[model samples]
Target: MDEERILERERYQIEQIRQLELEELQVEEVDSDDSDDDSSSENNYRTSGGASASGEFTYDTSLVALHSYLGDVEDTHNRLAFLDGGAVLKLPMFYLEGVVLFPEATLPLRVVQPHFIAAVEQAMTQVEAPYTIGVVRLYRDSPDYRRPPRFAIIGTTAEIRKYCRLEDGSVNVLTRGQQRFRLRRCWIDVEGATYGEVQIIREDSPLRTPREAVGRLAPLLNLRSNIFQKQPLYSPRACRLGDWDGNDSDAMSEESFESELSLHERGLHQSALFSSYHTIHEPTSSEDEKLDPDGEVHQGSSRLDNLLGPLREYNTGRDSAKSALSGNSGNLSFKRMKADKCALDRLREVPRAFWPNWVYHMHDSYTLAQKAADRWKHIVKAPSMDGFVMKPDLLSFHIASKIPVSESLRQELLEIDGISYRLRREIELLESFDRVRCKTCENLIARRSDMLVMSSDGPLGAYVNAHGYVHEVMTLHKANGLAVIGDPVKEHSWFPGYAWSIAECATCGSQMGWLFTATKKKLKPRSFWGIRSSQVADDTR
Candidate 1:
């Protein structure tokens, strides 16, 4: 009777999935047909070079405008424009410290420096190109901080979306990161305005099928599955696997049922679904039982246990010999070897042709965008993820922007162009971000869900100090080991009426962040904390 019920549930799930797939196909077919008609019409207009009776431009004014502003904006705007990979283009440059922009993310700037103000003005008035500037980070360790400070090579092109001139002559501008680029050469004009000749970094072709990506992420999925299994609350089979009376039927709605079933299916497939693509076979029941009960493998060890035992042992032996020769006495003598390199290489070698057809299928199967958006919603303390955009690149950049990590690590993520690679890295980061710790004392600080994105731009909040240096901070709702110093001072507070007190990590006696308390009785929550992203350790790194 139980077997029949399980089989019936599976059939029901498959039927529902098939229905959803069919609906998606219909939508795509309609979109494709409409796009074809529009393209044909556009071709006709281009050939005629005149306006149509229906008010459509025969001469491609938008294309002409894009070309006039930036030589080839139409070609590069939405799509991965570079076919052969990189191209050199001269563009106005803006330098910032401890901030890296990602594509589709927004960066807000308070332009006070004369050179930057001039750059913004130049961008605004330029008739040929759209208002765009190249953003590069100015590292403090660089030799020159005043005259064209040493900047990072990898940067992003930002399009000025909005700008306003303040009474003090400073400019407040909002810019959206468009694409990643590598700064090849930079020069400063006599007026101190900087210019960079940058090569646009092309993104990887979105050809990996959902199956292929899932296959690549098999180990991680399996690990997550095991974790979910251990935690009954998160486990999909938690209710079903236990004794349940029919009275619980009132609690199971269609949406909840679908979500549970989906999670359950994902768990089941994680262990064995991707095994056929690689040399390693599925583990036996006894071996599975013998695996780590906590579901965690050692650093640099394959999740599949003996999958690369020979290579790992060889590396282990080499490290042991080195340690013996050096007279090292601790387990630290064993350097963790990268066990995922072989797997990553294999994934990269998968035929590109297998991806394009599978792309939509994967999107339909896994719902990456929706899942990511939901996670972001919780992280940002938002009511819903509805306002968030859902494209892979956009979602990835959005999460990267809001994640409370050091600027250096964010910069590393910004430098990575491959969509899948970035998404995978982000997923790993998100997982670790759940429990933030102090870098100095490794004390537990904030949880990922406790993060509050107070700023519109990203997680990092910018504040100009009295001395005029801008500092970026990440806001958190709660933390541990923090001691508030003195009374909260309201003067020069960024949030206007709210007062702040210096907060230090109690364990190490190092400054961690600030505790802001509401002075007005109306303000809810009463108090919160803003931790410097630099002070937190990036476990992903």
Candidate 2:
């Protein structure tokens, strides 16, 4: 019996040795494959004319080039099935605080938690669909509260585009947001990883306005152009050597020209000239009497002259002065009024179905996307606007992701599934952000142009507090209608080396933002404002 047992043990040891050898061989083969991949990539880079002596490949900076690169990255992930109303999917959940991931937006993460690492590994090993996870924002009443986090009902599906495991067993991953889903049920497993059963949210169908409505809306293109055009609305005129009509022969004497030029330089020549011309050309009473056959004015004229002669003369002088100062102001005002009336008439003539098309023509994907890209460029100090994804839904989500607003507001935007509705909301938000004001009093607070983006991300940023809750902030260099509430306190401030004080709107006495004062005197501005973007009123209407 002892000899049989010994033989069995020897056989077991031999099997173990064979298994170890196989693992070592597999490791060696993997290392060799990695080296081959590296070599192939280097050769491809060189062939593409991107190689350098420093061993770094050059990349294109244009938006078109960026879009192509991102498209390739997206193609690597498993394509998700088209979402329908009743479709249900069980996915691993990644809960985040003060973060809302929008579709088509890329989110980079460094995962170190053990449970999360396991979840990623499990996801990677899935046979049916790998590289997909559910992401939802966690919510708590306060930052310092210690309780099981409540997650948002709406969540986005994220596809892992790139991932690498580090020596310390942590993972760095880049993920792209996909379709939105609603959490039906969620539970924490024994290993502390959360899993959710979610139903896919159906996206709104694409709708276009009728051709006639589009024609009506065509005028709006010019309106948009006028709003967004980079050139000055009124060009400033420079002094010229010729006469006003550009005829050298008709030019005034040097002394008169100098007087006129001086007035022009002071921006008062036209008004003064118009007033003097009207005064010198006043009609005589004898000429007026000759025109009247009965030598008597009509009753209407007599009444009007008696009632409004003084007022009319006063207004004529004032209006003449203004008209001369701004020669095109009246014309422009008249055109604007006509345009508005025309728009209203057209709107009334068109059917309700045509309104959607009208909106589409005015806020086309390209136009809105370009506007969004321009905003990002302005915020990030980039050379030019980035290429926008072709899909309208994706484009809207992309803009929402980049906008510097509160997390709650962004989450609210994410919850809306209609493409047109989402785009309209984004447009409104963008327009309103151009000017910040108090919600209650309608007093101007700050200009969006004066916004200071302090985050490494876009203008909006999330800061985790001591208790692990996150707060989103939008920073600004200046504001109005706000008064500091108390002395600055440095404890638990979001900005390091800075103290903060509660600030309220001076007009309405409503809470607005915080006054962040530098703790160190060397900071350029001694103080600045960090307003809650959600609290600002949407005055675009």
Candidate 3:
């Protein structure tokens, strides 16, 4: 009942905004002197936002209201998922600055520009039930004006969930990211709207070292054999199997080690290599349970001890022989003792390649997932992880959507091809992402520990300006190397109870972002700094 009442109130507010837009549109029409402009305007509403005779944008004052009463609105009830199965799509492109959308993130846009408004309407009127738009980040520093604006080759497809048309013909759209894509080509149409032919990117499944590979790695992990396997008298593998009954048995041969795995086992191992190609989440079969319970092949040296229990008993006998060799007076050991100690010393000189890279615990998906979840807990305050660590693929996207980093780093995460690779990259970035610096001059601005979470989306969030430029900014409690340039203005502030002032780099005079101060006395944060992602340096590299 409470939800219904809240939804009803939202509907009322939307109707009120529509009525206000109608009145504003009527007032603009009355102020205009050209009466015949209505017929021509209706015929060319789509073309007005596009290229004109002078190759410039035709700003329509009649479409914009004096003020917008609408706040960010999203339709979560009727959400749609994109599942075309890795097919290519031709979609309308919306290039934004400092914004990189990952799958499952939400983007709110105000379509005040004529070209964008036309794009929104075109998406809505399509035959498809769920309309999708390709969103790419624009490089704001690009100086080439003759060609199209430089944008990222990689982008995310956003499905329109809800849209509201205003009286002046502008639109407010709420979209949710569905899938990632690689832009093949992009061009501007005759009506001035941009379109792109994109191929959807398919992420590889979470990785796992095969059970047969674990069996092969067992010989490398046998620490006891590593110490004394070269000795003519002491072979741990032979002693454990009763093949060495103290009659000077030779050390186990490499040919025997290779023959232990049958042809059937080798075939199974080869098939497991490409198993991740077919599906995102493969079911765990009974054979998969043979691996370590934690999915980590090498948990500790204790795991090595547990694998060689029989050899451990044999080692006890060798220890007693060594003790007997020393007299009650504790005399120096003979040649055998010296050889044993030398082999023990050689243990420290084991080649790293002998252990094999797949045995590393850090390369495991579940291990990386848990580390990422723990790191996220240390950074953010609320929202329990609740089973997120179990799904490494989902957790990778969730962290990429909200991690407080520059747009370039976020785009790198989006372009990552594998789940384990993405998680590893994120963990490395989270560990090293300490300070935010200026992108142009590399001047230190603020520490990541000083970041303030102003939104549910974490320390960084996307907010659009009056000119329809979306700036992804990170909120910080304190910042340096910045100079506030203008008096605080409360109008159109992204934060409801804050007034904003332009902020610029103190050394280079480049526009950094805005300094926001709370207008209400009761607001908890008295003041904060917003630094644009584009201006921030990509220290993750």
Return the lDDT, model 2, position 112: 77
- lDDT to native, each model: 0.54, 0.53, 0.61
**TM-score, one value per model:** 0.51, 0.44, 0.63
Q: What is the C-alpha lDDT profile of model 1 across 1-541, one tens digit per residue?
A: 9958965764564453333223311101112322212323321210111111122212111111111111111111222232235766777898887577777766667678888888878766555345878988766543244655457899988888656677777766656778888998888877677888888887764433454344222112112223222542222232222111223333323345335334444444323323433463343324431213332223343444444343344345556657766896534334433333344345333432213444544443225555566665655544244454446666666667666787767887888766666666766665556666777678777667566544444555545443334455787655666665655665555543346677777678667778766554433344567787656766543
Off by over 4 Å in 3: 1-78, 140-148, 189-191, 208-360, 380-387
Higher-ranked by lDDT: 1 or 2: 1
- lDDT tens per residue, model 3, 258-314: 355455553443234223212322333323313232222232334233333323334
Alpha-carbon runs more than 4 Å astray in model 2: 1-86, 142-148, 210-386, 434-447, 452-541
Q: Could you tell which candidate, 2 or 3, scores higher by TM-score?
A: 3
For model 1, state the Cα shift of residue 440 in Å: 5.6
Q: Whose TM-score is greatest here?
A: 3
lDDT (tens digit, per residue) of candidate 2 on 1-541:
9958965764564453333223311101112322212323321210111111121212111211111111122233455554566578777788887578777766655677777777777667665447888889886654345776678999888888767677777666667788889999988777776788998888864334223223221111112222212322111121112332334453334344334344333233322212222222333222211112322223343432333233334334444456756763443244444444444334223322213444555545555556556655655453223645345666677777767655666888999866666766776676555776765677777776657654334455444343333345566766665655555675655554456777777677776767765554333344557776545665443
Residue 509, candidate 3: Cα error in Å is 1.8
